[model samples]
Target: MNEPLRTLPSIDRLLGHPQVQGLLAQFSREAVVDLARQVVEDARATASQGQPVPSLDTLAQRVARLAEHRWRAGPRRVINATGVVLHTNLGRAPLSADALHAMQEVALGYSDLEMDVEEGERGSRQEHVRYLLCALTGAEDALVVNNNASAVLLGLAALARGKEVIVSRGEAVEIGGGFRIPDVLRQSGATLVEVGTTNRTYLSDYENALTPNTSAILRVHRSNFRLLGFTHEPPLGDLVALGHSKGVPVLHDLGSGCLLDTAAFGLAHEPMPQESIRAGADLVFFSGDKLLGAPQAGIVVGKRSLVRMLARHPLARAVRIDKVSLAGLSATLLHYLKGEAVAKIPIWQMLSRPLEGLHQTAHKWQEAIGPRAQVRKGESTIGGGSLPGETLPTWLVALSAEGVPGGAKELARRLRSHTPPVIARIQEEQVVLDPRTVLPDEEQALLAAVRWALGA
Candidate 1:
């Protein structure tokens, strides 16, 4: 075998590449010089240690790797492949086109964030969403924070800190990313008094737990899971009555609070906030980013007194949202005001995309590249750690090996590695192209990826 000859380019020469310059901003001058020194040290150290030193060109690659360590944005865009819309991994629900438009308008310029234009004086940021939220949810008042967790924290801290909070053991949930109920309680300085078994908690159980020291009853939605056999939980109305009779308010934390009950549209039913309020929940906390299909925000809506108390809490300042979140959320609530919530929310649009329409989309992909692919039906998920058991009906295209086995995995890898990666599910040794999440224009790319992976 002939010994391989190597041509080593100089470090200074290799830095001239555009890619290197693109990443150099990630590191400071001193850091860049230090990274360069390491490269030289390693190359020299390998020579002295009787090892084949990597060439100077290879050394430049090493410096680039080092630069990524010092500076990189934490978030990256990924295609939601696993047939999951609102994928928690993919940053949950996507913003609606209307919401995005609002974001662009606000994000691009200075707007009256804290100014009352009509009054010609400084104003509260809360006004933007308060009336809209109240109008949509039938609440006397409303407040928007950074996320649901913060909303819950502010409510609990304001209402129950230095007091006891009675809760059903079953509703004491620990959901995605290890966000436990007990932890939120601890941080809020509210003591949790478990009332009943994890599977069953009655109205009496909550009544017995309440006392003068009890400031509130906390009801959490068991949205992620449903209990089957031997299941019994008190209705919200009954629980509210019991708490109010004892001069304590009831707070319900609805994890995936829907603006509309999706089952009405032929999907699994998610409880809406209006229903919860009408059920007499004294205060309600819900996620703005989940089923609502807006920006990441936690909305608290309830009786004006309780909302006012929450607004005064010191923790509310810490959990306050920025102008952009307020902008996006206010616009989302306006859609609700116009009775356009479902049609304007992106996550809802994907969820409510008719099966017939999905079939047509899959058929379009099939026709777009006739005979080069196979389109079929598959189920998609409403992810974001919201709905786990329920799989929404969707249509898909199944791309398999032209003449080879195990082609699905190869196709998956190719889609994931493409420019602006395409995420698709793999099932039964075939690459499943879910039309539920893919934009119509991207069908060409999807077909191209499938055919390329099939080696067509």
Candidate 2:
């Protein structure tokens, strides 16, 4: 054996170390043993490569770190200093307090998820949120699935399988994560018949595309992107009229699921499910998390017969929402029904924050972060594939990297590595933290994390 390899500690010896013992107390014995073996194997490989193996203490510490990393339950809580409300990568749309409480209540104990307490019979989990959805969207009925993609898949499979679904060429887009409309249609066993140009599609385009095999007319809202200047597409009501005239149902995919009017908040108007239903769309689909500010879910609201058909489909069972998410969604909808969404939902609260308040918050952060940080004007976007190119004016606490070890990128990395990771953005080589997206209660922690990242 090589001298360095011979110096490697045995797995048994490493497992007996204090740090490894700490790991064992926190995790399973089998898991810790496996990690220790992995660490020792890594050290042996390093020694074989003509590199010195770490000491026994270092090896044991490595095992502990590996165990902690492997065992820590994740999708962990993070502070969003990035100013991107509805950040898809960070688990979009921080849940409202009511929604979080509802999730906790259901997760902590047994829920009547599929039980009919009033009649002493088996029931459906969908019943919890169906009525609330209908009440909120003014639909005759409603159905929910795991997410917007699954909802689209279920709707297409149940309604248009083995038939032709007509969609505008402009609306057949690929949103974030490569979720293409044509791909989804093909997956649902439906044929996609594209009509008209990408920048302009008229009511005549739909009228000309109608055929005996036409199953449905799909209207996908361009929620994530916009075509400016020369863009023209028939309105929802026009398409609805055309569909009804030909006895074909119109299915509107309002991706962002905005319940409130965006224009009221100084943003361009985003299509709403209630407006679609009001415009005679047979069914309207939307996401629960994005602009709706709820848990991740795909919600469908429309005519009773259509919703009933969707509920009865086999795909419905496969894509049904879980009990915890259903509880959260229910509480979120109640915030809307009670007219308390602006005050209760986190995203809405962030959106409604006045510019003056944001400036004040940024100034406070700058004061706390010392001389290297300064208050600067910035913009906060409504991310998560909603309201593309729309930004809200805000103030940012910008930290310059002058004299710092590895510059702005390193500072941002250090902040992310901190406990309860802080997510910020870089602009002009400065680490910029937006006060708009950070929750009010997380201010102190954010300040501390920034201080640590700056090595103050």
Candidate 3:
């Protein structure tokens, strides 16, 4: 054996060290013992490779770190400095205070999640948010599932399975995470009948595609991307009219589920579920988290009979929303019903933040981050498969890597390594943090993380 290998401390000896002992208290003894063994094995390998064996204290620290990496609960809270409001990777849509409180209230104790307190009988979980959805979207009834994808699958499986569903060639899109319309239709046992050109699909194209086997006319909103110039698609009302003439139901998939007008925020108008319902869509599907500013869920609001069909389907039970998320979603819808969405919802608040106020915040961040950071004009996007080409003007705190070690990438990485990791973006070889997306309460933490990353 190498001299260093002989000097390497045994797993039992390492476990007795102060750091490893602390780990044992936090984690099970078996887990700690396993980590200790791995640490000793690593030490032995290092020694065999002609490296000096780490001291007992160092080995104990390694065990502690290994345990932390293996056992720590994750999807940790992070500060969004990336300027993307609906960031999919970071869990899109931070809920409002009321929504958070509602989730906590339900999670802390038991509630009548699926019970009729007034009637003293069995009830349904969907009843919790059904009325709120109908009142908000002007629909006769509504249903919710785990996500928009599930809602689409359920709708297709229940209404159009073993039948042809007509979709525009241009609207056959792939949403985030590789979930495509064609794939979903296939999974639901529905045949996809594509009509019209990719950039131009007229009412006639849809009519031409209609047949005796056509179960539904599916109109998917191009929420994530846009075909600039020379793009022409039939209106929702036109599609609805055509479907009615053919005695087929029109299903509108409005992917962002925007309740408010985006034009008010200086962006292109996104299709809303209410507008689709008012236009005579039989089933309008959308997401709860994106523009609705709630928990992750799929919302379907339309005719009562159609919604009931989806609810009664076998897949509905498999994809129903949970109690906690249902509670949070109910609270979020209340914000919309009360007409306080802009004031209460986090995403709306971020969207409505004034340009001047953003500039001031960027300057404040620059002040805290020292002279290396500079306030510059930049654009913040509404990401997460909503408003693909839309961007909102904002200011950014830009930090150049001229004097920093390892340049911009390294500086950004160091910021991400901080506690409550700060997510930023790099543009033109400089790390930029947009104040638009960062919550007001996270300002201090953002400043501290920037300072640490810059080694100020």
Candidate 4:
């Protein structure tokens, strides 16, 4: 073993090899050295185990394989075969073509992200989309943050820090990724004053909770789950009136933001930002990625004074949205202004797509993949904690390989590892793909990937 360990090539010798040198054009010298170190470590470990030491040529092959793996491990695109629209793990919202183009335009060059072009002076980055958001949501002013959680944190810290913030016990919820209202308030330096029981809350409860130290009343929408059969909560107008009467602001965090009336698409009606603004809520926060169908952003819209206070807060600078997200969000909002969001945005398109269209897609996939694939009626969800207990009827192309080695799991792995990976769900020992979320242009590639997976 010691004899084979001596055969291991030195670091400088490996770095000078043709293959390693070729990698330098694509990867940094430091990165190449790091990868070379990993390969040498692995070979040394094998030799220590009394296994045959790999030759220099074999180590060079290892370097090539390792380099490619590192590249592939970085962010790469994958087809969303899983029916969870707005899939959190899949980067939440897929950008519209216009949004992608807008990001590219800004990313390639600079175009006054935080400068007033006409005035030739430094300006606010929020100006890029502030007017558009205000026009769409009917807010007096709007502010953009990195995400919804940050929006809430900044709002509380600006308005209620060192004061009591009243919230219903029922709305003191822990959202996805363990983000809780009470925890956020704690971070904002605001004291959380819970009112009423977990099942019910009344306007009287909030009124009773208000003190001279109370600065704001917080209303959190239950976006991820529902409390039915006896849940009673104060309406936004009622809370706004109560807060205003006490000289306190009301901040409503509508976790999943919806610009349109979802009931128009036969889905449950979620609270819209415009409705909150109209109802006189002093401040409102919502997510840009969820139902808004844009990049990951948290938008704060409300009375101009309240929003201005938030913008001036020191935390606002720490949680502001980046230029790429700002550009994408601006482009997405433009679709609503043009009265074409339902037809233009991918999330809205999938939500409003006719059942007949999905069935047609499932049939096409079934035909292309042969008997191994079955076209069946299935259900897709408006995932990302937007609409709970409401499922969109979808059609699925289900694949089965019961007799094959490793069965359905092996088939799924092959498709996942395919070039431009195809991600699907497994149910009842079969791989299921809901075409409702798949783009029509991706059909051929999906079929080829499936055929390869099943050895058809």
Evaluated against the true structure, the overall lDDT of model 4 is 0.91
Clashing pairs in 1: 81-423
Worst 10 residues of 1 by lDDT: 1-10
Worst 10 residues of 2 by lDDT: 61-70
lDDT of 4 by residue, 338-415 (tens): 999988999999999899989988898899899988989899988897988888889998998776689888888989
TM-scores, each model vs. reference: 0.88, 0.97, 0.95, 0.93
Off by over 4 Å in 3: 1-9, 40-56
TM-score of 4: 0.93
Q: Using alpha carbons, what is the TM-score of model 2?
A: 0.97
* Predicted model with the maximum lDDT: 3
| Cα-based lDDT for every prediction | 0.79, 0.91, 0.92, 0.91
Those runs of model 1 whose alpha carbons end farther than 4 Å from true positions after fitting are 1-28, 34-52, 62-76, 369-372, 401-407, 448-456
Q: How many residue pairs clash in each candidate?
A: 1, 0, 0, 0
> Clashes in candidate 4: how many?
0
Candidate 2, which segments miss by more than 4 Å at Cα? none
| Candidate 4 residue runs with Cα over 4 Å from true position | 1-21, 46-61, 72-74
